[model samples]
Target chain A: MSGQLTLYTYWRSSAAYRVRIGLALKGLEYASEPVHLVQDGGQQHAAAFAALNPQELVPVLRHGDQVLRQSLAILEYIDETWPKPALLPADAGGRARVRALAQAIACDVHPLNNLRVLQYLERELDVAAPAREAWVRHWIGSGLDAVEKLLAGDPGTGAFCHGDAPGLADCVLVPQLYNARRFGLDLAGWPVIARIDAACAALPAFAAAVPEAQPDGPRS
Target chain B: MSGQLTLYTYWRSSAAYRVRIGLALKGLEYASEPVHLVQDGGQQHAAAFAALNPQELVPVLRHGDQVLRQSLAILEYIDETWPKPALLPADAGGRARVRALAQAIACDVHPLNNLRVLQYLERELDVAAPAREAWVRHWIGSGLDAVEKLLAGDPGTGAFCHGDAPGLADCVLVPQLYNARRFGLDLAGWPVIARIDAACAALPAFAAAVPEAQPDGPRS
Candidate 1:
């Protein structure tokens, strides 16, 4: 809202998708500078993009002079900078719970199955396609199962991951579930998450942030 | 600190060690309930422990009746609940930078090299020792190399990761560097990080929170 906001993102990157949802949810407009992850040995690794984010990862949000990386961190920054329609819960305990739920997927599940890791498994470790697929599903399934348990029993759960409003956890969760489906994992196993996803999908913010809706997406 | 604070942690868990440093930094007293990750087929998976954290992860901090999982989230929780020595910076941009730096290791490098993931790489994929070791080094080296870039180029980085104070990023970085050494990854390559680690190591708080100093650690 304050500066020339630009996001270096990829269509299929779950991390990037998470940030996209955060921006959409905040009703913030930004320029998308798509960095193709798979084309030509990863455009993310290119000197220019790498200069922006030395991690050579996507979802690098540039707000004027400020360069931000890591999806969850960016989400938090967005929430903090534009305090209207807060992404996290009001109470400290609730914020902790939402952050935990988001990290359950972001740190634990998403990192293990990202593009570079999968590439390493294939090219470096010589893991076959089916095995790689299984590896992806294995982590996603277990991680989601844990998340389901976290949601199922907690009295705090409502229409979304926190209360009725979709916040940080929902932003992180929707993209992860999208990635899970992309890798051929079923959502039927986690009814709570499935319902949450349905709720998130009903929102135009979440709808506009999907991979297929991105400028660089295949369908686009 | 009100109510009983009990941490269900594993000795060698990098995640748990992070929370320990956070608690120590805050001068908060807590009971350490060590859950052996390797022994007894990982006590984390035990029914009772699993009930506490359905994620079956360590560093599950129970403050009163509130159970918190995920190290970074727990660290933020500690910061918010007891805002004595802030783990994050006061300014939004600074907080974003610190969180991004912390997450660069937590979400990107650490998860790829953690116990369960390594086990999957070996037991499931049959990746041999040398290859697994290489895999660990690859992630750590690249991650730290990027971290080095993150620290070196930024004027914001001081004696510690952010402005001479050992805050959130330092807590995450030190344990990661420790794990890097455990896997035979040298820290000499990242001078900025190595120097910061040295600075952090000199603190009694960080020293007391080390894995070797824990009740379940080897020395203890």
Candidate 2:
């Protein structure tokens, strides 16, 4: 945890945003190497970035010599390496619940509405822009609805997705909500998720990791 | 590990297949509650299953009173609950590597080509059969290609994805390879993955988890 760390990040990428929140929460400092997924046919597709992650994806963490891809895996690695302010709950069952919430977004939701997938729908499938936007909103709505049920229905829920603390699930939820808002989805229906998102945004760790705060963030 | 365990699984679900492999690896027994994803507008959509998992997805693990959703989370829970014959490595870096390899399939590849996504392509977008097949193969090919490099390039990979014994990555790999073959993609191109798949297939733990071996397997 003491060595030099570098993060390959994109300002608006939800997966990258999850990692950013994780690093900040752990109080770990790392140099940022921005990989634009859009500019010039995606800098992630460049030979140099591809060498780092053959998947040609962002949010690649370089911890010393070991390069780790996959946002959830990287989050776990961080949690294991630096156990303080643990990202996951101590018990196995609690950990499973938290992870299920995270995957509810990362696997079940975000993958469907990813930029690359959207691009494929547009380029290969010839989906119109409105249709593509609808696709994004549809998945986000259903995904967040499931998440809201998980969060609201469980007695374990406190101020966050798991316990009172903002943990792994919160890390994923904040970013997904951010993306949802960008698509003009009204989140008033998901009162629990909205509450958690608001709470997370108040914290410096989550606040600093917002898409607009990154070095490569969009200029307003 | 010695209590009533129920798995709501679809016969050919890769995600459920991954969990079945994990359960078998840990030598735990469970009752199979087949939730046919296709029959009668998908049993996963029924009210009972929805109460278990709002995501409306297969591979819901019911251990006593606790209902666990998401395959990767279930795998880790099983590993944590039963330490012997551990699925993840002891070391932090090794665990990260194994998790990354697993996510390379679970997240990067499988979600894209899942039945829900494919059905969306066909029903919602009116994507033709051949184009849909191309989409599936494209993801599987690209995904497995990344896995092959990660395994073959690293010394950490032994007979299995991580070590001499089959672990988490192998659990994910075997099922994905099975799905890929069902799609008629040649495994010959990924010699490393092919070799590991063969090794995993030889194990009774992995062999018992094959889609065809399940009680709910295809009638033919």
Candidate 3:
């Protein structure tokens, strides 16, 4: 059941970055095959990738012969297969709480602001640059604000989203906040999110998953 | 923990609809406290609703003091707490696969095509009405097509998304297809999705959760 572990990823893709954090946290290293999201209408849509993932998305994890897609699902698979340093709490309520927080970002925030959606707005809707930026800023600002409230208000928030240790919520949150920061959204309103992001940033798992840390991280 | 299960929901919100289906499937009745998404800039964002959910979106299940947001979280909570008519499988890989199929819709498809995102596209991007619909059709069609392929190609598909029983993935898929049909998106390509939707429709749990079946269901 063991073979070469390969991850199809793009450096700046938040979804890919989330999986990278999970893999690193599990301390399992895999071959990095970066799929450029922006070049050539996204190599993710190429025939080879479609053969791998009909959804034509990055962050497809190849574990031996079983290829998995979707960051949250892949995270669950990793947790199941590895079981160490449990990314989720043992209790059902605790797991529910963690998944809820993760979905607040994954299902609500990041999806609305993804690259393909933005490209659709530009090409199909003819959204001008400024308006597009405004659209990005508006959702990012609101979403981060909501996440901050979720973190600050919920007693579940400890040093991280659940307790003193990093979990699934952090895996999703850190990458999303990084994207928000990339768009230059005013994050001053989000003290709790900033604090949680800082907690995650201190860890090797999260630190290693940053966009700039990837093999094809943007050339500065 | 059982006093007055109030669901903060919208008439047409598929996420909310999923939770409604779960509640029905478990034979648990709840109060439908409508949070209108389009009227008054969304009642979900009101100061009162925000207190319960910082995300301020529909499908907030309030069971006494424990307020749960996110449909999947609520579904899992119900499943784990009640432990009857379980919404997940008995085994781990089966659970993972079911959850993966559910996430394929809840996180990937529904999130990208939700009301707020569509409104943003039109209001911010100046996307003409006709082109906006093309965008919707593109996402819903392709996303459902991917899901259909997953069901058709996998050995997993039986009477539902998992086996002879309806569970998390079916809970998610039914609502998404409801929304897709509401938008008049073409479903000609996804016979698998259509077949599953038909199977779900024959059941009382899903039927009762349809928009028309609710107290706040949109009047035809």
The pairs that clash in candidate 1 are none
Q: What local lDDT does model 3 show for residue B188?
A: 68
Model 3 error, position B39 (Å): 3.7
* Higher-scoring candidate on DockQ, 2 or 3: 2
Q: lDDT at B47 for candidate 3?
A: 94
* Quality class of the docking in candidate 3, CAPRI style: medium
Tens digits of lDDT, candidate 1, A1-220: 4788899999889999999999999899999999998888889999999999999999899998999999999999999989879999999899999999999999999999998898999999888999999999999999999999999999999999999999999999999998889889889989999999999999999999999999999973
B95-145 per-residue lDDT for model 3 (tens digits): 777887888888778877787777876776667788777777788887887
DockQ of candidate 2 is 0.83
Pairs of residues clashing in candidate 3:
none
Tell me what TM-score chain B of candidate 1 gets against the true chain B.
Answer: 0.98
lDDT on C-alpha atoms for all candidate structures: 0.93, 0.91, 0.85
Q: Order candidates by TM-score, high to low.
A: 1, 2, 3
Top lDDT hit: 1
After superposition, candidate 1 runs with Cα above 4 Å error:
none
**Residue range A1-220, candidate 2, lDDT tens digits:** 5678999999999999999999999999999999999999999999988888888888899999889989999999999999989999998889999999999899888988888889888998899999899888888998999999998889889999998999999999999999999999988999999988899989999988989999999877
Once fitted onto the true fold, the runs of candidate 2 whose alpha carbons sit more than 4 angstroms away are none
The 10-residue segment with the lowest total lDDT in model 3 chain B: B120-129
Q: State the weakest 10-residue window (summed lDDT) of model 2 chain B.
A: B1-10
Task: Give the least accurate 10-residue stretch of model 1 chain A, judged by summed lDDT.
Answer: A211-220
Q: For candidate 1, lDDT tens digit of each residue in B22-76? A: 9999999999999999899999999999999999989899999999999999999
Clash totals, every prediction: 0, 0, 0
